[model samples]
Target: MNDSEKISILSKLISFKSVNGHEKAIAEYLQELLNKYGIESEIVPVSDDRADLVAEIGSGTPVLAVSGHMDVVDVELANWKTDPFTMTEIDGKLYGRGSTDMKSGLAALVIALIELKQSNTPINGTIRLLATAGEEVGQAGAELLQKKGYMENVDTLLIGEPSGYRAVYANKGELDITIKSKGKAAHSSMPALGNNAVQHLINVLNKIQASIKGYMDIKNDVLGGTVFNIDVINGGTQPNAIPGSAEAVLNIRTIPEFDNKKIIDLIQSEIDQYNNSTNGNISMEIGMEIIAIIGNVNSKIIDLIKTIAQPYMSKIKYTPEQIKVAEKQSELTGMPFSTTEIKTMGVSGGTDASKFLIDQPNNANYVVFGPGENNAHQDNEYVTKEMYFDFIEIYKKIFVEFFK
Candidate 1:
């Protein structure tokens, strides 16, 4: 397919107001796109409004599966200069809500796969595309696909998240826990009669703060640790009545050394201790868990991906704005001029790859590479034309090489 064809496909995808909870329409769009080329696909239902697209080409060994999320983050109309759903190319960047965070990646994959089918290449193995839903929320689509054994036979997995065309071999995992407290409610005038759930929750928070070091002390070489956020806390409603129920949520990004299971164990242990000591009516439940993905540095696929992305890296010039904090930190420095370094590193965010690892599905080496920008979930998200077009070529080249 030509560049214009690729852009048109992407525009159609972006036109759907997928937002977060709505992905079924886009999944239907892709199913029709595949049907045009006589390519067979199945729509894996995730919810009433969400579904995953799984399309495959060719037959036999060393399966290479390309995976990506279909759902994009919700957009703020006031923050965008243009319609967030309209795919517009200005200067060379394609601006849209999912343009970078990854409609482009999935579009590229679709184009490459369809083109390969039309080329009539002698098939030796399978090439699959798993376009998932709910990756931004909790990876529900991927979880269902894995449970149904979609990833069981795959030999390699490529996560097409926005990586500025970098070959990301590792990324941090995520664990979301909801802690609830229960107590008696009473009118504010009779303060001594009611046991405040808010107070109970506060006591539990203090225990976590005082004892659990979390990821503060732990660190990873590529994907550094130190993400422990008490993101949500809710307790009393009316000022006149003491709260009988309260809940708080915790988000932790885990590395290989410190994983989701271990983190949950630590939190459970803390809750147990708190309960035993003070009769703290606190109970905790897991909201979500995404395992950290790490691939061997010496893997042949990593080297191949790095080699393929070298020429494109020079054309990409995106760097996230650094936030200057009060703490003493390393000084900012610029990159070397005329350098030939390939963008091969780790990311600190979590992807749907984590959910695929729950059952230990084959030894599929998962790597994330896409035409994404760092300004994801922000206003005016976009993907450079160069990154999007080059990734199509990259995907094509990798498939040919891997099959050969």
Candidate 2:
């Protein structure tokens, strides 16, 4: 397909507001396009408004799955020079909500499939394109697909998440921890009349931060290190009386080495120590929730990805060995962690590839590749025309090679 044709298709895709869970319209659009190409496609509706489209071009063992999320993160239209949902070509860049973050990847996949069909390529294995929804929410679409047994027969899965033309074999898992503290409330006039939950909550948080220093080590090469941030906090009603409750929500990104449960335990221990150290009448409760994404490296999958990107592979600062070392150390150190058997490089964020690879039945060789910015959730989201077309060529090459 020509660049003009690719751009036209991409523009149409960007026009649709397939934001996160609301992906039905775009899914149907893709289903129609795939059908026109004689590809057998199905819309697997996760809910009434959200759905995932799966299209297969061939049938056989060792199926190759080219996947992309069908949703974009919410965008504020006022901040953009052009409509965030309207595809705009300025200079060489195509600006839109999902342009780089992955509508481009989806377009590339579609073009590649079209080209492959026109070429009458013969293959031994099946080629499946899974355009999933709700990746920006909680991976709900991927979770649903996995629940429905879509991942059962696939031999390899490729998630089209922006990785700058590099293969991402692993991604860091995440855990969100919410800590709440309670205390008796009374009039502010009498300082000794009542307890302050906010103060106790602050003390507990400081202690936990100090105690978890060991967990934040930057020893992993690929994943680098474990990071945590108090993203949100709330508890007080007004400024007058003593506050009776306080809470903080932490966003924890863990390396493959640390167990998520162990991290929770560490937090609990720190909170317990704080409660014991303070004689104040304060009670604390900690709730920990783990979101394990794709991390660690599966040898088989790594080998396959390397083969696919052999011509484009180059030396990078972080090697797979370093990531493996970090993973091992985290596991050995007894920290709350989740590990992926497959390793994907050049990735700093999470993707549905995590769910597809981890929860899938067969040990599929999986990697996340796409076009987009590093800080995807940031403003002025844009992707270059060259980048978009380059991804199309890559997808075409991989598709032909994998099927052959």
Candidate 3:
């Protein structure tokens, strides 16, 4: 497919509102698109309205899977410059909800595989396209795929996540923890009649933050140190009454130095201390757990990806204004691209890549690479037209190089 055709495919992909739990429409669209190329695919059900679409070309031992997620984070329509579902292009950048977060990469991967099929080239190994659902939520689609043995034969996995032009080899582990503080409820007019659960929750949060500061001293150059964020909190039934219970959700991103269990222990230790000091009503529990992944730099696939990307690295440049626009991305990704080379960097959050790596740790090689800027999960997200075009060539070359 040509550049226009690729963009057109992406535009169609963005048109589907496949947000988090709702991915059936987009998955069906991709299944139909692949069918037009005579590619056979399987739609694995993830839930009532979500599924994973898996299609393959060629066959052999060292199977390679090019993957991307079908689901995108929910968009607040009122904040968008254009309809979040409509692909809009202006000044060389394509803007839309999932244009950068992943639809562009998803389109590029599909088109690249289709082009490879049309070339009539004899590939020695398999190339699979795996588009999954619920990635924006917790990677349930990918987890289900792994559980069903779909990833068993895969030798290498390439995730089409937004990474500017860099190939990411490591990412921080993520854990969602819910902590509850218990207290007695009393009328607002009463003075000191009830223990304030909200106040107790705040105290626990403060202690956790202080403890994390010390933990931050332990760091890795690639994945960095463990980080924490309080995502949600709820307490108090009415303004007049002291709450009986309060809850706060915490998200912790950790390096390979610490696993999910280890981080939980750390947080529990803090909670234990707080509980001992207080009436011992504070409690914590793990809500979600995703392990951190540090790829084998010595893996043959990693070397191959770096080799394939070298020539194009110099081609990745940012305009002064473009750099200005991507400042927040630069900060979030820790990629000072205006001055530094576009090479391996730790992803600030998790991806479906981790799901594949977790199960097939020994044989499967995983790398997150894509063409879009780091506008993922951000407002006014976009992917450059130039980069989108370039990614098609990049993915094509990698296949050619790997098969050769």
Q: Which candidate's lDDT is highest? A: 3
Better of 1 and 3 by lDDT: 3
Q: How accurate locally, in lDDT, is each candidate?
A: 0.80, 0.72, 0.81
The superposed Cα distance between candidate 3 and the true structure at residue 49, in angstroms, equals 0.9
Full candidate order by lDDT, most accurate first: 3, 1, 2
Tell me how candidate 3 scores on lDDT: 0.81
Best by TM-score: 3
Candidate 1 — what's its lDDT?
0.80
The digit string of per-residue lDDT tens for model 3 on 175-236 reads 88999999988998883888888988999899888877777778877787887899999999
- Candidate 1 C-alpha error for residue 275, in Å: 3.2
Candidate order, TM-score descending: 3, 1, 2
Q: List the residue pairs that clash in candidate 3.
A: none
For 1-404, candidate 2 gives per-residue lDDT tens digits of 67787788899888988876678888888878777777778998888898899887767887877888878888876777888888888998888888887888888888888888878887677888888888876677877787788888877777777766455666666666778887778788874777888888888888778767777764456666777788887766777888877888877766656756677888878777777887444343443332444433663444555565444333223357755775575476332222322224533467776667665422346677776644476567888776687668767777776654
TM-score of each: 0.88, 0.80, 0.91
Candidate 2 residue 262 C-alpha distance from true site, Å: 1.1
